[model samples]
Target: MRIKAAVLHASPIAKPYAETRPLRIETIELDPPGADEVLVKIAAAGLCHSDLSVINGDRPRQIPMVLGHEASAVVVETGAGVTDLVPGDHVVMSFLPTCGHCLPCAEGRAQLCAPGAAANGAGLLLSGAQRLHCDDGTDAYHHCGVSAFAEYAVISRRSMVKIDRDFPLVEAALFGCAVMTGVGTIVNTCGVRPGQSVAVVGLGGVGLSSVLGAVAAGAERVIALDLSRAKLDLALSLGATDAFLASDPDVVEAVRAATSGGVDHAVEMAGSAPAFELAYKITRRGGTTATAGLANPNARISLAPVHLVGEERVIRGSYMGSCVPARDIPRYIALNQRGRLPVEKLLSGTGPLDEINAAFDLLDQGKVVRHVITF
Candidate 1:
């Protein structure tokens, strides 16, 4: 099938600037799914920072790749042996898949499945061959194992989670990544309980979702920190108990003051070294600091050993919110359906695939939460 997609032909090899090389939308051909695969007609794709990381060379990936990972769609075709999902089913594409027999999956940690990484990262099907190509017959690499930037994508059946048909695909797409990562950090990693005090650094899409997650988990004080006043306002509306502008040098002190001493849980979503430092410092003794951001390769964070030894604080790294998509994506959808997860406000923009560059611009400027590419 012929589909429209944004293809990244070369790695940025430098910081991504809008005036420089940007993802280009072109017509491409998608091969039919092989056995154990499924072809999906993408309804909405969420632009994630990780995709931008690949473009900027922060996350080194093969060139000429289709750069999108978070998406929701309907099943169009299913290859042999796929009986659980059939055509016409709405689904969310998961970057990680559980092979069931893999050590991680069998251990109930599907988020770290090994085969899922090998299949998706190699840009090959489970059978070891490409599934997308340029109209002129050049190869197209798949990003994050599931490139959902195109109108249609062929992915492994293990990489999709069936969702309620009535759920809005646009909002559901965010759950595939942003929401999952943000909320997962709170529930899965931090295990935040009722009346717990939390601080979420960076009020972007991921940070805001963290705030909502903290509130849903019944946190009494959800403090949000960011330089953008606009995002802080949005954070407040989404359930943040208070917002702090990090531009002020006294931001950490202010957060400490708000939480009485220091927050019980601090989540770093800014992906900046400084933010990680602040997350670590702003937690009370015995508190937990969770780093959920995808930082650049050269970024380094430093902390005093005296503080670590004295505070006895726990610092952890979260990947995809430690989520098992098959189990978590559906629960997130239910959260949205029950009015617990406010997702509509998180959507900042929607346009055709050609507007991808513009969407990235908005993201870089911190002007929008998430931009959806509609094919």
Candidate 2:
């Protein structure tokens, strides 16, 4: 079938995406879902930094690829050997497509599945094939096994997490990435307990979501840190007890003073070396510093070797917030439905695929959070 989709060609494109226009919308061909795959007619998809990373050449990938991973869709058709889902079932797409039999999947750490990583890097489904092709006969690699920046997507079953039919698709799209990564880091990765002091170092969608997660988990104090005052205000509205600008040289000290000697847990979602360092510095003794940000592949953080032993500070990396989509997506969806996880506040607005280039500009400037492309 022919579908209108956004395709990213050569990277290192200039900014103001509207001018350079790295991601171009074009008519493309979509193959039928192969075995263990399903055809998802995308309802809504979010514009994540990860996608921008490709266009800006921060995270390079095979050229001529469809770019989009966070999305909500309806199962238009199921391929052979697919029994658990059928036509019309609403679902959210997981960027990682777990083969279920990989070593990581067997250990309940599907987020680290090697096969998924390889396929994502190569821009193909777990089956290792391109289901999308440009009009010029070039095969556009799939992005994170989803390639949801289009009208229709052929994705693997492992990437689909079925959700309630009544759930709002636009909001459901955020669960695919931001919510899962943010909230999951708190509840799953760090297991933040009630009355604990937590700091979220970044005010993007994921960081903001972490603020809500900390509050919902009963954190005694939630410190929201960011360079944008606008984002800080939003964080305060979303339950952050205090807000600080990361640009402040004494920001870490301020956070520590607010939490009576640093927070018990600091989640770094800014995806920068400085952000990671700040998170580590503001963590209380024996506190955990968890990072889910996708910093530059070449970026490095400096840690005090002695502090590791003296302070007993723990540092860990969180991919997809250490989330198991099947187990966590439903739980989060329920939370959002009940008004506990107000993810609705995270969405800035929506646009058609044509305006996606402009949306990328806003995303680049951190002018919006969770901008969804409505199909």
Question: Which numbered prediction scores highest in lDDT against the true structure?
Answer: 2
For residues 109-205, write the lDDT of model 2, one tens digit per residue: 9899889989998888999988998888888899999999999999999998999999999999999999999999999898999999999998888
User: How well does each candidate superpose onto the true structure, as a TM-score?
Assistant: 0.96, 0.99
The candidate scoring highest on TM-score is 2
Q: Model 1 Cα displacement at 91 (Å)? A: 0.4
Residue pairs in candidate 1 whose N, alpha carbon or C atoms collide under 3 angstroms: 120-145
Q: CA shift at 199, candidate 2, in angstroms? A: 0.3
lDDT, model 1, position 202: 88
Q: What lDDT would each prediction earn against the true structure?
A: 0.86, 0.92
Question: What would the C-alpha RMSD of candidate 2 be, to one decimal place?
Answer: 0.8
